[model samples]
Target: MSLGASDHRAIQPDNDDIESRIEAETLARMHKQLEDRRSFLQRTTSRRSSVCIYRVPPSLTEVSANTIAPEIVSIGPYHRDRDTVLKFENYKWSFLDYVLSFTRRNGNDLDKIIRSMSDLERSADATLISSADFVEMMILDSCFILGYMYLYTSQEDEPTFSIPIVTRDLLKLENQTPFFILEMMYDLMKTINGDSLELLALKFFNLKLPRRDEEILKSTYTPPYSDQSIQCVTLLQRSGIKIRRVKANSFREINFKKATLQIPSIAINDYTTTLFINCIALERCTPHIRTHFSAYIAFMSCLINSTRDVTLLGQDGIITSFSQDDQDILFLVGIQTVIVILKHIA
Candidate 1:
């Protein structure tokens, strides 16, 4: 008898239906998880506008994939849209650089390793990857690297905030992962935030993740000011975002399904509480559509850690931070070595 698609048991010899069942269940779970993550992230837009960024470095390789295939197959095809290219490139680099060093490398179980990766392809809204099954194993190659980028750019680095390094390559990498790798990708992501960045930076630079008045963000918790009069007021004069006032009813806007992720304990107030959300059913990702996430990080850092030198704003090192909403805990780091100091003492 042919096994149903959802059967968990692996197809033993002579079972023709086993492969199809496994593939179908794999795809079903992949899409379900993607939708859940995208939905949850959208709802949290009031804070964490750019979300986290990742990068699959160029040092990943085929031999490593074969070695790790057992652990990877433990969970059939998961989200790995970006890491495919990263490993492809990295393998070439590693091979060229380490030819002499690798000749003595062991090749035990080499055939099974290569066979496991022989045929593969990935397709998803944000990426489409086609390669041998062995190639798909690149997904696990960059967990530590991704974690590094998160630690490098997270909120701990005040006034001088920056985007994670992986966020930089995301534009280029998302086009390749077959839909199967998305879940594994999300799993690796959980390791980036929290204390990773702060701890690493301190260890490397003999420095600290300076604590700005945490209360600044803690205090934006009053009621919102009733001033939607200025429909769009931009704090960054240089940023070319179109801004206008939201009149009581004259609105021309894109449709993004309304969703909210509320932290119930916090009630924050601010004169400028802005949102630019699209309510359309987003189906696919245009490769490289988002050019830069760091700009947003820089801008937010300035807001959280620096006071306005003039009405327009200040980029100098003199820093004072205040969060507009407790939810948007924009931390900042700064340096003012170039600015001349003026003395006024009695």
Candidate 2:
């Protein structure tokens, strides 16, 4: 019952035709994907845009997923729907009510405020939310943040919200409302003149560390800028290098001169880890922005390999850990991991 040679030859051609068809389909799909990607890149890269916020890099997040996550409350679109974070929604609503009342009393129109924020949301590629949702989000999140800051700075009683946990959430990379939004809202609602949002937020986070005098505060840190970079704080200290707390306004302001590394004065607290890490994440993700923060973190990571490094910095007043435990301090910075990451990125 064996098939003849001609029959076998005929089947072979049919098999060949099917195989060829499958390969062609695969190639077509790949080609289409490439085209789509090219189109996307073209649109996104054609113009320069301000990216005041960003998602943490997946590679970095894989190392510590919770580092950029909002724990107690969600401020932005990324974590807006998590069950754990939704509990704060009620509080946000209440804050919004209070803010609206205050703004009205101060001669600010709620509709005009919403319209302004809506216009900004339309112009910026900040979120994927629809126009209506974006305006609602802006009003709610902005009001909540302003109210929270007001209560926090004024030392008013917060009956429902946990200020400490809320502070930590606010500093998380995924939980940010843009600084411009806050600035605009502040301009519209301020009862009196005050410091900028940056300074006010810094003050709220207790990051405005005291300096010795105006001279040191004004002095800039100029790094040696070389391919050769140190790996840890202990190593630097052991090599007769000194770390000084400079009274600068920004964490990105770091300088090295005559074996002394001057970094902006930053107080270590419960929120410090999230604050600094998110700042580093932002610097890493934004292309047009300076990498000063990333460079600083990379440099610090190189300098801090172990608990001994933490101990050295702590003694020098360059670092303070809320936990006071060396291991806890080390965990917060992930210095060894950061060094490896920066090496690969560089």
Candidate 3:
């Protein structure tokens, strides 16, 4: 009954063949998994690098999520479906209708608008949740923005929402369609005469802040620390450093020379806070953009530690606070967490 040597040899060859096949199959699966991971990484890197619009980071939201959220109207996909924002949806449609009526164009104009927005789909923030109808949302939001700007500049009838509140809402980081979309809608509608969309926007906001042709940002630049902690404005004064307002158009033109810190006088109000916070968020999300706002904010936060600092800055005309409560100014500029975040980002 015992097997002969030749039979045993034959069985050994069969076992060797099975083991080789099993190893080959396992190696094939391993190679496939490696390829899949590389593909996933490539896609993610491409999306992250090119994305401009982004949802506010959770680190920032932890301070105050509502700071970046739209109050009156949601202009982008991030908050379009919220119950509070849904009420304003009807107004957007009304604005679209007004455009159609004014232009003497019918559904064909609407179709053209949809097609144009659709072409820019790739530019939408990759981090955003996919909208059911992104083109429709873009058209409606752009129309609302253009219509509001027109109403604001003309001073016709008062809009349903207060002008300042709506302006703040429109500028929210999460509540923005691309500026190009606004321009496209404006051109298609032919609603305004003899004014570019950029001019209309500048007029609508009435911003004194001037635009720079080029912003030189040294991303590798690190702040020189004299001590473990940055001194507040009062402390800086005690150290024989004079702080005063300079006649500069841009707030970013801050300079320190011969112990004198010269900063452009900036208005601090609810609207100003909204603008600053949105600009900071934009810079944070899009790394390629200049971090002027974030750096400015971190520097301001370090300078204004208490009400005394705010008072000193105000007396010097470095800060013009529209808010009656000095504590509000303190809260606006004393965000220590933001300093940490900005430092890490830098």
Candidate 4:
């Protein structure tokens, strides 16, 4: 209040110095935050378009890991480190040897396969391993699949591995290489194999659902949604809604016509439970894909509640159970346990 001109001049410089220091600190923090944000955005967008393989979400695994986990073989990076699957390493190498023998390209087939997969490493989400290891994994896994499919389709003596269990393991969401990888490998060895990869796979899995061309034309991939209250199988049957088998190409081709709930016949086996669970997991992880599989499972869960429902479905050939025990059949289709996880995704 009583300061001289010299005192004012000294205070002004101090104030200016403090303001400059504050401004520099604020700008530095802003730059750091922006840089961090930019790096995060780039990392996320880089993998979004190409990421196809995924581990089962912990929420799902918490419900039942047995259904989601691979038992015998681990095909891709997600479960590659499993000790249970590691025992099959030699078998994969054996299959790779078998594959090379058919190539007739003087050891060039492997080189070509590895090179092709190396090019795909970027798009195939190769962060789980080194670039060399990723390509190697792709090559070995692809050969094993093709070799197995070849032996399976050709009926060239039964495979050393249990056909059903290995088949089931191969379908696990975590235990898969990209289909295109297998296709490219097969193209190189197709001269020795008689069928296309699609045909071979369908035959190997025995997924031949009888389909009418006209019914396939009528098939829709939309999830079935209803505003009406859902009813159990017994209640629906009591209400005179007949459940009949509709031969269609896709499981999502469910329809109602003339008081008949026409659903495609589905085999409820040891594999059925795991198969649908993995499919649901895939749908949940990949949001762009429709949740038809999850919706269908949820719809089926709604319909199947009691042994009587399972019996009725079996009588109609809508559900053919490979297991003899009623409880096992119930466990496979009741799969209401999956409904808990589906609620989140569906």
Tell me, by TM-score, which candidate is best: 4
What does the lDDT read for residue 107 in candidate 2? 81
lDDT of each: 0.28, 0.69, 0.73, 0.75
lDDT computed for candidate 4: 0.75
Estimate the TM-score of every prediction: 0.24, 0.67, 0.70, 0.71
Q: In terms of TM-score, how similar is model 3 to the real structure?
A: 0.70
In candidate 3, residue 295 scores what lDDT?
Answer: 71
Itemize residue pairs with steric clashes in candidate 3.
Answer: none
TM-score of 4: 0.71
Tell me the alpha-carbon RMSD of every candidate: 21.3, 11.6, 7.7, 7.6
**How many clashes in each structure?**
36, 8, 0, 0
> Rank order by lDDT, top first?
4, 3, 2, 1
Off by over 4 Å in 4: 1-51, 106-109, 115-125, 156-162, 190-199, 207-223, 245-253, 322-325, 329-346
Ranking 2 against 3 by lDDT, winner: 3
- The regions of model 1 sitting more than 4 angstroms off are 1-167, 171-311, 315-346
lDDT of 4 at 58: 71
Q: lDDT tens string, model 3, 139-218?
A: 78888888878876666554565456778887788787777777777777665467788777876665334444242111
Which tens-of-lDDT digit does each residue in 230-315 have in candidate 4?
Answer: 68779998999998897767767788899989988888766777777787788877777777776777677678787777778888
Clashing residue pairs in candidate 2 are 221-255, 231-302, 231-303, 232-302, 232-303, 232-304, 233-303, 233-304
Question: What does candidate 1's lDDT look like per residue over 1-346, in tens digits?
Answer: 8778656344444455667788889999999999999899887752232312222221211112221222111212333433543343444333222321221243323343234324222222123234543343433332223333334444455324332222222222322233323323323234424444334333322222122333212212222222122111133333443322222110121111222111111111120111100000010122233312222222333334323322122222111132433222321222111000100110
